[model samples]
Target: MPEYLVAIRSGRFDLAALKNLNTQRKDQISPLISVRGTSLQDFDNFVDDWGDRLFYLDISRQPKDLKEPRQQPDKPQKINILLERDLNNPKNAYENKRSFYSEQLEKNKNIVPVVSWRANDPIRDIARCAILLNKGGEQAIGVRIPIGKNGEPSNHSKEALSTILNSLPTPEKCVLIFDYQHISSFPSTDEDSWIFKTLSLAQNDYNIERAFLLSTSFPKERPDNGSSMITACLDWEWQATLRNSFEILGYGDYATSDPDGEMDFIPGMPTIPYAGYFSDSHLIWWTKKEGKDKEFSKYIGIAKEIVRLDYFHDDDFCWATIKYEEIASLGGGDKSGYGNNGVWLGFRINQHVAAMLNLANVNDSQIDEEIDLF
Candidate 1:
C-alpha cells in the first residue's frame, strides 16, 4: 500500500482521533493507501528516517520530501504529487528546507510542476532562482509582476507581463511566482492592460496549466469586497473561466498583516524598470528619512537626493544609520506621518555601495543591506 501524510493546525488536531482516521484511510484504499495524520515534527522524522522511500503531502509546508527523492531517482513511487504552496524565503530555515527539496525535484526525470509565490526581489536573484529550477535538463516556466509603493501594479508593469504571457504557448504548464515585478520594462510601453487581457486569454484560449495571481491591498472603502488580494485573483480566475484549472493560494494570511513590511522592497536599492518604461520616474525609498515627505515634491526631491548621496557615499546614512540630528535640526513638525524625532520613518539606511555590494558570494542579492550603492 502507498502511504501518505496529512498535516493540519497543531492545536485543533486530535492525536487519538487521527490514529483512527489513519486506520480508516488505509482500509479505504483499494489495495490500501497508508495515509497517516501526524505532527510536523513527526513528518520530518519520517522523511529523515525513510529518506527517499517516503512520499509526502505537506498541505502547507515546502516540498522537502522531493529533495531526497530527486537526488536519488531510483526511488520511484517514493513521492506522489499533491497541490501545495511551498513559499521559499532565505530567512526561514523550514522554508529553506522545502526550497531545497523542490530544487531537487526539478532535477528528477519525473515532470512535477511547482507553483511558487515570491514577493518581488532583485533581477539577478530572480534569474538565479529560475535557473536553479531549470537545472538537470528541466524547464521551469515563470511569471513575475512588480507591486508599486501604493501596493498597486504600475502601468508599465502590466504590459511587461503581457509580453511574457503572449510569448508563451497557450497550453503551458509553468511555475509562476505571483506578483513578482523585478525587471523594469517587461516588454514595452502602452501594453499595461495586456497582462490582464493575456491572462484572460491564457485561461480562456490557451487553457493554462496553472495560474497564480498576486492580489493588491484591500480597499477599506469596499467592506463587502474585503480580502481584495484573494478576491481580485478569484475575480480574474472566474471571469477568465480559468478558475477550474487554477488554484489561487495566499502565501501570507489575508486576515493578518505581513510582519516583514513589503518583502519586495529592498532597502536602499534602485531597480531598473523593464524596457519601454521610464525608470527615472519611480523612486525607491531606502531609508526612513527618504520616505519622510511622500508628496510629489518631497518624493522627487528625495529621489534626486538618493542619487546624489549614493553617488557621494555620505557618512550619515551610508551604513544604515539614521540621521536624527539632520532631521531634528530641520525644526519641522512631524506632519510627514512619522512622529516627532522621525521615529516613524519607514526603512533603515543601507551601508553598502556599488563598489562594496558584491553579489558573487551572496546567492540572494535582492537585499540592499548586502549590496553597495556606490
Candidate 2:
C-alpha cells in the first residue's frame, strides 16, 4: 500500500475531543506524534518519535469536515480517509520524499530552485528553497533548474541538472526544500533513463544529507495491483532518508490574479541561489526556424531573457525589432535552422551567468550594445 502525510487539526474541541481524534489517528496509523505547536525542536521531536511517520497537528484551525467521508467509510465519518491511512503508515511517504532530496543535496550545496512553466508557455517555476549542506552558511550555493520547457522537465533536464551542480561553490552544506512543482520531475529517467541511473549512482558515491522535493506531479495515477512496485519505483525509502535531514523552509505565497479564474504562479523550476545569473542581455535573443511562415515568426530566446523580461514590465523590455533577414543569417532563419522544428528557437542560459543581467535596466544602453546578432 502507498503511504501519505496526514495532517490533523484541532478546532474548538476540548482536551477529550482532541485526545479522541489523536487516538483515532494512532489507531489508523501504528505510530503517531503529538504536536502542540510549531517549534523546530517540537517538530524534530515528532520526527524522532514517528521516525518517518511524523506529521503536523494543525490545531490552530478547526478540523474541516469531509463531505463524503472516505471512499469506503461509514456516514458519520468525514475526511480524506486515505490520508488517515497514510498517517498510519507515514514512513512510506516520508522515505520516498527523502530519497530524492538527499540526492539533490549531495549533487550540489545551494538553494536549488526549479520552475515548471505553463503547459504551453515553455517556462515553469520549479525551485526556490534555500539549502544548508554543512554547518557553515557562508559557503552556501544556490541553483535553479528548469524542470520543463512549458510545464514539465525540459528534454534537457539531465543536462540542466549537471550544469547547475557543477557551478556551485566547493565545500558547501545545505538546508533545502523542493518547492511544490519540482517534485514531480523525479520519477522518470528521460527516455534513455540516463539521468535516473546517474542520480542513483551518484547518491551511493557521495554520502549526502538533507533535502526535499515538493511538487504537484507526484503519482496521481497508479496501476492496479502495482501499488507496491509503484512505491518502490518512486524510491520511497530514499525519500524518507532525505526528509530526515530537511526542513520546510516555507511554502510559496501565491494568489491568483485572473478575473475569470484565479491563475496562480506555482514554483515549477528548480531554484538555486543567484538564480538570475543567466539573464544577461547578451545571452538573450529571439530566433525563428527556417521554412515556416516567415510571417508568423517564433521567438527563440534564452531563459535569462524570459526571466529578465518577467522581472521588469513587458513594456520596458521589447524584443529587438531586427529584420528577419538579420536573424536568418544567424542559425534560426533558414530551412536548416537550429532544430528540425519549422520555428523552434532555444537559449543556452544557466543560473550563474544569468544573474549579471540584473543590471540590464541601469545599463540598458550598454546591454543593447553588448548583444547584436548578424
Candidate 3:
C-alpha cells in the first residue's frame, strides 16, 4: 500500500504533475484519478504515459457521451490499475456495466475492481458488484465508502458495508477508503470521535490491509482579498491529527486543486496574474491586478514575490520552486514568456506532492526542519 493517496481530476495539469514526480515519490503515493468527460484518445494517452504504474482509475463522474475504449491494446505487460465506477448513473444498465468490468479485468491481468458504496445506491447492487469482482479472479478489491455531510458515516453505512463485505471471501485483502468530499472547516472533536469509531470498526471486523481517509479543503475560487490571500491547510492538519491518534489510517487529499474541480479559464478575458506557494500548513497566494505592467510581466512579479517569501525553498526543492526562481530571474526585455494557467497549476501540484511526501515521513523532531525545507 502507498503511504499517501492523492485525489485529482484527470486533466492535463494533474497528469503532468504525476508524470513528472521522481521515481522515489511516485512509489510512495497512489493517485485516485477521476476521468470525467475525457475522450477515449485522452484516456489512451494517459495509459501510454503512465505505462504500468499503479494508480486508481475512477470513471464515476464520466458522462454518457464519453464511451469507454473498446479495442484493447496489445498485451505487452499487465498494467497495475484499480478500476472503479459508481452505480449512481441511472442511464447505464447494471449488466452492461458489469460486462465492461469483465472486459477490463480480462485485458489487464493486474487490474483490481473497486466497489464504491455510495449513499444513494442500493445495498444489493453494491454487494452484487463485490461478489462478481471477487469471483472474477482478482486476489483483492477496493471498497470506497463516502462519509455523510455531518462529518461521519451515514446511519446505514455500517450495515450497508457489512452486506458488501459478507459477499466477498477475504476481508483482509480489501482496501478500504472513507471519503469526506468537501470540507468547509477543520474536523471538530465530535467528528474526530465518529471517524475514530468507524476506523476501529473497520479494523476489528475486517482486518483490512489498507485504509485511507480522503478529503479536500482547497477553495473553488480565490478569496476576495486585495493582492494576496492565505488559506490554512485544514485537510493536512486534520489528517495529521488523525495520524497522531490512529497510526493505521493513510492520508489522501485532492492535491492543490478544489474538490469541486478546477476553475474554467475563459478565452480573451483579462484575468489577474497570480502565483500560489504551498507552505507546511498554509497556501500563500500573491496576485497582480491589471495595470501598467503586461500580463506576463505581472506573472513575473508574482513569481518574484513568491520566491522571496520566508517559507520559500531553494530551486533544488522541486520542479516548481526551480521554475519560480527561473521566472524571477528573467529580464523584462527577454521574450521567454511566463507559462499559462495550466502550466502554473502543474507547477503548484508538483510541489504540493513533494511537500506532502516530505511531511508524511518526517518525525516530530524533524518537523521544524521539514517546514524550513519547504
Candidate 4:
C-alpha cells in the first residue's frame, strides 16, 4: 500500500519549460560564483558583462515558475533511489521512498539532510521544464536553519542566522567558471595578481571551455567577504570540491539530518571555516559531453571532491542530463545567507576537449552563435 508524493521541485533549470520544448538544443556553459563586486571594469566585460549575451541569461535573471496557464509537464521530473531495494516489501518502493523521507525529517524540525539516491541512476528527470529556481531571490534566514541531531548549531539557528547575514543585500554580481586543466589544484597567487593574468591556470586545455569569469573581486582586490576561492576553510581539498556539489539552492544552513555542525560535511571529510566562504552567481548547466557521457564524466568527477558535495549535486543534478531534487519540498532552498561557499558553481569543460574525446576522434565543442543562452 505504498503511494506518497509531495515533491515541489523546480530547484533549477526550467527556462520557460525549455523554451516551450522546441528541440535542437545547445548553449550550456554557465558557471558562476564571485560573491562581491569586482572592479577593473568588472574585468574586461566578463562575457560582455553577462545578461543577454544575446538574451539567454536575461540580465541578473532568476525568478521563474511565473508563466502559469497550466499543463506544461512534457515529462522529465523524476527521482528514484533503491540502493539495494527491499525494506520489507509491504509494496516497498524503497520503503515508500524511505518513508517519505522519514516523514520529512519527522515533520521538519527545520529540514536539511536529504540525499539518498545512491547513484547507479535508476531514472532522474527534467527536460522541457520542471526545475524552476537558481539565483532566484528571497531565501535567507540560513535557508531554514534548525539542523541538530549531532550536526549541531541551533542556538535558535544561531541567533536567527546572525540576523539574516546582518541585514543582507550586498552579495550579488558573481561570475566564476573554472577548469584550467581540472582545476590544477588551486593555490598560487601573487596578491590576486590580476587573477594571475585574468583568472590563472591554463596550460591551454582549451582554457575550461571559456565563456567568462573576469576578475577584480576575488583576491585581486578582495572585498566580498575576502574570498579567494579554494574553500573547506582553505584546502580541505577545497572543502571536498565545494561541500559535495551543493544544490539545495535559493543557498545555505539546514544543519541536522546529520549536520555535525562547525563543519562535518564528511563525503571526503570536510570540517570548515578553514579560509573560505562566499556565494551568489549559482547556475550550473554546461554540457559538452560527447565522450559518450561516462555518467557526466563521473558526475563532474564527483564535483571537484567537496566531500561528495551536497545541497544539490549529491541529489545528483543534471542527473545524466537533468532531474534534481530535495529543493526543500520545492519552496526552494540552500542559498542560506550565502557563505560556506554554498560551494561554488559547476560545469566548465575543456579538459583538453575532455581528454581529446577520450583519445582522438574529436570535434564536439561548438555553439558560439554570438552567444544567447538561458
Candidate 5:
C-alpha cells in the first residue's frame, strides 16, 4: 500500500532493474518519480516539492539477477539475524533513542526533556533530574521540583508542567527521561508494581507524548524468566501498557558508581578550553556516571574551549547523560560524587551555556584548558 519515489541510479544500474523489482513487488509501489544526476541542492528542492507525499524506494544494494522472482524458492526462510549493539556510539545515540516513538508523537511540535534521578527513597529519586520544557527554539524553561518528605510533587513542578502544557498549541508532547533505576516507594499499593502503575497514571493524566527510559534496574536484577535484561534495556518487558505513553529504553549510558558529587580543584585549578586534542568536543557523551574525576575535569574542560562563531550547533550539539549519581562533588573532601546523588550536572554547565573563563587563564586564547582536581 506504500508508494515510492523510486530512484534510478543510472550511474550504477539500468532502469529495467526497477521494473523487475516492481514485478516482484506486484506493483505495490506507485508513481515512481525517477531521479538521476541530481546534486544535493537539486535533491533538496525535489524533496521540498514532494514534501510528505514523497516516499522512499526500498532498493537493495546487493546484486539482482532480474531474471526470476526476487525471493528464492529453494531458500524461502529469511536468515536468522543477530543485531549489532553499536547504538552507544555518540554520533548515533540520539537517533537510536529518538526513533523509538517518532511515529506516535509525529504531530507534537515540542518536547520536554526530563532527567529522572535515582534516590534513597521514592521521593528523592523522582526529584533527581530537571524538567526542561522546550520554549520554541534553543531556549528552554528548566524546572527542578523538590520532593517533599512524603514524596509528593512540589508546587513548583505542578506549576511548571501545568503552565507549559496548558499553553502549548500541541495536543500531545513531552519526553520524560527517567535517568535512574526506579521510583521505589511512591505508591503504597505494592513494591513490585509501583513503576508501571505510576507511569500509567502519568499517561492518562498528562499530555506526555513519549518517554525514553535511560535506565531501570528492575528486570536485570529480577528477571523472572532467568534472562538478561540489562544488556537490552529496550526490551518489551520494561514497556508499560499506558495508553498515552510510548516509552523506549536507552542504551545503558549512565551506569556508574557516583552520581551527584562535584570535582574539587586539587592543586586544583580550572583551565581554559583549547582547539587541539578537543577537535570533536562539540558533542559530549556521558554513558557512565564517572565524569567528576580528575581526568574527567581535564578532558571536558579542554573540550569546552570558546568558539565565537555566530551560529548554534544543534545538528551536532548536546547529548548529556544523567545517572544514579551526581555531576560534581560539593562536600569538602569528597570527590566521590554522591551528595545524596540527585546532584545533576544539567543544572550547571550544559552546551547551552558555554565554558566559563578559568581564573587561571583570563586572557589566554590558545592555551590548553587543563585542570587538577582534588
Candidate 6:
C-alpha cells in the first residue's frame, strides 16, 4: 500500500500537480482522481502521460446543471449494448457514448475503480462495479465510505457496501477509503470515536486489505482580503488522533483544493491576482485586486511576499518553490507571462503534496505544535 492517498478532482491543474511530482514523491502517493462531467477526458490524458501508476479512479456524480442534453438509449439498453461490444475490437460503435469511461478502465491496468458506498443508486453502482471488476481484476476496486453530517458513516453506506460486496468476488482484497470531507475544525473525541468504530467494523467484518482516511480543511470560500493564512491542521490532527486508536489506517486528503472540489471561474467577473503556498499546516495566500498592476507584476509581487514569509520553504523545497523563486526574481518590466489561475493552483497542489510527504518524518513534538497553532 502507498504511504498516502491524495484525493484531487480530475482538473488540468490537479492532474498536472501529480504528473509534476518527483519520482520519489510519486512512488509514495496513490492519487484518488475524481472525474466529473467532461473532465473525464482530462483524466484519460493524465493516464496517458503518467504511464503506469497505481491510482484510484472515481467517476463522480455529474452535477445536473453541467449535464449536456444528448440523445442516448435507456440505462438498461445502454448497459447491454456496452457489455456486448467487442472488448478486443478497437473500433466499437458506442465509442462516443458513456461506455468510453468503462473502455478506458478496461484498457488501463493501473487504474482502480472506486465505488462509493454512499451512492444514491446502489443498483447502478453495483452493476458498474461488477462490470469494472469483471474486466479489470476484482482486486482492483476501492469502496469509498463517506462520512455523513453526524460525523459517522452515512445511513445507507453499510447496506450499499454489503450489496456491492456480495455482488463482487474477493471483497476482502478490495481497498477501503473513509472520506470525512471538509472538516471546519479538528474532530472532537466523539467524532474520532465514531470514525474508529466504523473502521473497526470494516476490519473485523470485511477483513479488507487496506483502509485510508480522507479529508480536507481548505476553506470553501475564497479569502476576503489581500493576504492571509488558513490553518489546515484538521486532517493531520484527525489522522493523528485516529492513528493513536487505529494504527493501521493510511492518510489521505483533498490536496490544496477545498473538499467541495474545483469551480470554474466566471468569464465576466474580475479575478484577483493571487498565489497560494502550502506550508507545514497552513495555506499562506497573497492576493491583490485585478487591474492594480500588470498581471505578471502582481504575480511577481505575490511570489516575492511568499518567499519572504517566515514559513516559506526555500527554492530547493520542491518544484513549486523553484518556480516561486523564479517569479520573485523577474524584473517588473519583463514581458514574460506568469500563467493563469490553473498554473497557480498547480503550484499550490504540487507543494502541498511534498509538504504532506514531509509530514511523515516530522517529529511528534513538532506535529503537536502545528496542531496547537490556530
Alpha-carbon runs more than 4 Å astray in model 4: 1-32, 35-44, 47-49, 53-374
Global fold similarity of model 4 (TM-score): 0.17
For candidate 1, the TM-score is: 0.28
Best by TM-score: 6
> How big is the positional error of residue 373 in model 2, measured in Å on the Cα after superposition?
57
Please give each candidate's TM-score.
0.28, 0.23, 0.79, 0.17, 0.25, 0.81
Q: Write the per-residue lDDT of candidate 5 for residues 258-363, one digit (tens) a residue.
A: 1221222224443221111111122111112223323333223222222222122332232221211122223335444432212222211222121211111233
The residue-by-residue lDDT of candidate 2 on 229-344, one tens digit each, is 11111223224333333332221100000011111112443211111112234433222122222322232232223333422323212221121123334443434332211111
Q: Which is the better candidate, 5 or 6, if ranked by lDDT?
A: 6
lDDT of 6 by residue, 192-268 (tens): 46666666766777666688888887666655545454555567766877766665678888877765643555445
Clashing pairs in 3: none
Ranking by lDDT: 6, 3, 1, 5, 2, 4
Instruction: Point out where model 5 deviates above 4 Å.
Output: 1-152, 179-198, 205-207, 213-253, 265-374
By TM-score: ranked, best first = 6, 3, 1, 5, 2, 4
Clashes of each: 21, 80, 0, 39, 15, 0
- Best candidate, lDDT-wise? 6
Model 4 collision count: 39
Please say which candidate is ahead in lDDT: 1 or 2: 1
Tens-digit lDDT track of model 1 for 1-374: 22111112111111111222223332321110111222244333333433233222212222332232223346534332321233344233234534645654443323232323234433333333434444532554444444554434555545444444444443254433344222222322122544455455665665655444333221212122111111111111122232233343212111111112221223454422100000111112233122222232233333334344432334342222233223333323334422221121111201111111221123323433422323
lDDT of 2: 0.26
Indicate the residue-level lDDT of 111 in model 1: 23
Runs of candidate 3 exceeding 4 Å displacement: 62-112, 117-119, 155-159, 188-192, 262-271, 281-297, 334-336, 365-374
